[model samples]
Target chain A: MNETALKELLYKIADDQLILGHRNSEWTGFGPLLEEDIAFSSMAQDKVGQSHALYQMLQTLGEKDPDTVAFMRNADQFHNCILVELPNGEYDFSLIRHFLYDTAEAIRFEMLSESSYQPLADISKKIRAELRYHTLHANTWVKQLGSATEESISRLQRSLDSAMPYALGMFEESPFEKDLISSKIFGGEQALKERWIKKIEAVISQTQLRLPDWKALQPVTGGRTGKHSEYLQPLLDEMSEVFKIDPTAEW
Target chain B: MPTREQVYTWLEEVKDPEIPVLSLVDLGVITDVQIINNEVLIEMTPTFVGCPALDFMKQEIHETLNRHGIDRVTIDVTFRKAWNSDLITEKGKAALKKFGLAPPPSRELFTELDVLEHATCPRCNGTNTELRNTFGPTLCRSIHYCNTCREAFEQFKPL
Candidate 1:
């Protein structure tokens, strides 16, 4: 693939992490439960770290520095998973997003951990370490809330019901999935999606909630294609406001 | 290259911000220390990510080197590879055992997260323990409860 296309694709992945991480960080102190709070916070930190590594990879192409890539891009240029761009709903909604997104993330990282690209594999290792905790956290909630207080169960199912559509966006393809696979930059994306669905199905079955027929969801041209929900603009506004104060200032 | 005497002298002054008996170098947390161009570049990994003492340690590293008028020092934390208890030195292992948290039979003998890898009662060696919760006073450790010892102790969770 050409350098421009590669950088763009890498930026999509980096920006997705950056934006999703920003959204997750917003709940740092506010999570409903303390352990979950720390868990969420830790996941957010790891995502930022992963973004840094991806930006470093992007730098190999001699384009925007990590900060500029993080701060300068407008919403139209971003290609993160659509699921990450959605607004945080109720606590259950956040957990739903966490469960769905993180489950996919775990498989994604698992594949990347073995990527032919050394730096990417190395980072995938670091990311997967923290993601294990995140996966556990989300799974625990899926089990607990799926079988917890009436309110908790209801909220969880409702969130899962609504978010299920957007969740499909997580697997939406990028322009480089084929080359990324061929180059062994990371394994085939479909293998990741397959594991993601299977793993989530197994876990969700352990709860009181009925798994949404996986067949019901259809892919949407969300963030993967540079389109995003209304939430992205506001999220980008808050995250970049600090860096934009003096974009050139070393952070 | 640091002479053994110089390295020992440096290690003596650096203490873990959480557990003072432990020195950063002694903990084997400092993997490689190379002094070049009158500047020291130190590579170390934290016991866990989000380790609060790390920021303090970085500051301590800078101050320690500055005290020697070593113009500059860079303390780099690598997370490419996870830091395992095996990374701790024998003396560091002894310190843990003496402190009542028995060191693993030996680093090599311990499988990746051998059941023994979890927190042993720093008060009494107990295999049957319960994690009261995951978070602790610090991010690097977890608060675990030993039913046998009837004590609450901090266990350093593997990163």
Candidate 2:
């Protein structure tokens, strides 16, 4: 594969992990319960780790260090989805966001597990191992909140209603969709969509929450092609604050 | 230069910060210890990502190797495979038992339940236990309670 095509692919994967990790980190001390706080923290760290591995892989392709790649990108230059970047509105909102992202991530990772790219394939395998926990955690919460006290059920219903509209926009494709599809870097988007639909449908039915009868949210365009949400700018500002102050300083 | 046996022996002395009776190596978090000519390269993985003991583990690994004069030390942390109860060595299990924590029982269903499930008390060996909570003092475990003992205990989580 050409160098540019390769970088595009690596950056897209890295960017998604990086941004989603940021959103999840916000739950560290704030999750509704202690177990969830720790559990959510684990997912956030795994996402960061995925970014770290992808960044290290990108380093082999010859541009920047993982930290630089993660912290230095411009707001419009990020490739993560809007679903991942939007703020966590409530416990239910966070669960919905996680439900969408992780379901997609698990499917994406399963496909990437067989990627033609050996290094990517290796990382994908490792990432998938951790994805199991992420799946269990998210699914458990959705089930509990859906079946819990009326306060919890109502809150969850409202959160789901509010968040589902933005959650569908996470599937925006990149420039190398065809090459990735043909090369088997991962499975086709159709396969990903199909699995995601089946898994979420089962979870939604179990929760007694209806998948809104409305049409799925339209793709906002450009995230996979390196354009991102306005929410990204402030998030990046906080995330990169230290790095920008002194690039040579180590934590 | 120390031989591979010596490296292993030295690593054995490095106890897990959280579970003192158990060494990080015994947990299989440190998968391999090699002495290549003069330097030591330690292949390690965290039981969980963002493990609070990780910094201390790395530091101890580095310090232990250097103190014994193994030249240099490099620890490669991998998270490719999430750690589970199976990784805890027999010695690690023994240590947990000594510390009055329930070691994994042989039952397959025992493996299925995490801290979220009931674990018999190590002190009283009672099965009438329920999950008290999941946040323990460290990231590697969670707090559980036993009605028999009426005391809270830490359960080594299958992260």
Candidate 1 stretches with Cα past 4 Å from truth are: A1-9, A247-251, B1-12, B15-21, B26-29, B34-41, B45-59, B69-82, B93-118, B124-129, B136-138, B146-153
Docking level of model 1: acceptable
Listed in order, each prediction's TM-score against the native is 0.82, 0.86
The C-alpha lDDT values of all candidates are 0.71, 0.74
**A56-143 in candidate 2: lDDT tens per residue?**
8889888788888788878887877777788877777888788878888888888888888777776676677567667776887788
Q: Candidate 1 chain B TM?
A: 0.72
Candidate 2 residue-wise lDDT at B91 = 84
lDDT over C-alpha atoms for residue A229 of model 1: 79
lDDT accuracy of residue A46 in candidate 2: 73
> Least accurate stretch of 10 residues (summed lDDT) in model 1 chain A?
A1-10
Write down the TM-score for model 2.
0.86
Choose the strongest candidate by lDDT: 2
Candidate 1 structure quality by residue, lDDT tens digits, B1-159: 454357546755788887776678767678777777766777887665445567788788778766766556777777565565567677776676676544434435433333433566767676677765444455445566788878767665454
lDDT, candidate 2, B1-159, per-residue tens:
777778888888888887788887678787777767667777887765445577788898778877876658888776444455678889888889888766755423442435356776788777777875444555455567888888888777554
